[model samples]
Target: MRSQARQYAQSAQHRRAPPVRYSVAAAAVPIVAMVAAVYPVPMAVVVLAVVAVARYGRAAE
Candidate 1:
């Protein structure tokens, strides 16, 4: 059986994680793939958008 402290650590670790957001977004990858397949988006445009969002998120943090 897990100890109380280990349980507390697990709970805290779950709450503190940032990758949960990434996991949810990752789940939408197939949707993005389908959309991209229907309408071919430029690679440069996608890279620029991702970079812009990353910069914005970092700045907000």
Candidate 2:
């Protein structure tokens, strides 16, 4: 049918959006050191990680 052909054409014209991949290695390096410390893992460390994830997982403006 014409509608089917139109739908097929519309679908064919569509393309996927590009992937936006990045790494938080910069933030993670310090956190890893913090985690490896001999003392107890504190909430401040957890907060730092959350902040790091938010801060580093963005496209740098």
Candidate 3:
């Protein structure tokens, strides 16, 4: 019973980290887009492509 309880607690602790990571990532994306917009045309496009690839990679996981 004690081992089961410990395992549950460990799983719950692991569950908590993702929301903090996701929220920070969510916030940063817009700021990055805004900054990207300030760049000359090709660099802005490159930034957008990078963001897209990053999003795709995360989605795959």
Candidate 4:
């Protein structure tokens, strides 16, 4: 019974964790761009925007 309970707990923990891809550029690039935009860095925003679009677009393909 305790072994079954441990298995269930492990499965639940895995499900609750965010998908690994979200930690990659798919999620990170946009956040960095937003912060750079607030700082009024035109170049950083442009570069970050291009990078994010390309990254997500490729993932969708």
Q: Which candidate leads the pack in TM-score?
A: 1
**What is the lDDT for 35 in model 4?**
76
Q: Per-residue lDDT of 1-61 in model 3, one digit per residue for the tens?
A: 7699568656966876444444456556766677767865577676776677568657644
Each prediction's TM-score against the native? Answer: 0.45, 0.31, 0.39, 0.33
Candidate 4: residue pairs that collide: none
How much is 24 displaced in model 3, in angstroms? 0.2
lDDT of 2 at 17: 25
By TM-score: ranked, best first:
1, 3, 4, 2
lDDT of 3 at 9: 55
Q: State the lDDT of candidate 2 residue by residue for 3-58, as single tens digits.
A: 99567645754763222332334436565667757567786876786666656555
Q: Ten-residue segment with the worst summed lDDT in candidate 4?
A: 17-26
Q: Give the alpha-carbon lDDT of every model.
A: 0.59, 0.56, 0.63, 0.64
lDDT by residue (1-61, candidate 1, tens digit) is 3498467656866887535444345445566657766888986776675566556555544
C-alpha lDDT of residue 20 in model 2: 31
Clashes of 4: 0
Candidate 4 deviant stretches above 4 angstroms:
1-41
For TM-score, candidate 3 versus 4, the one ahead is 3
Ranking 1 against 2 by TM-score, winner: 1
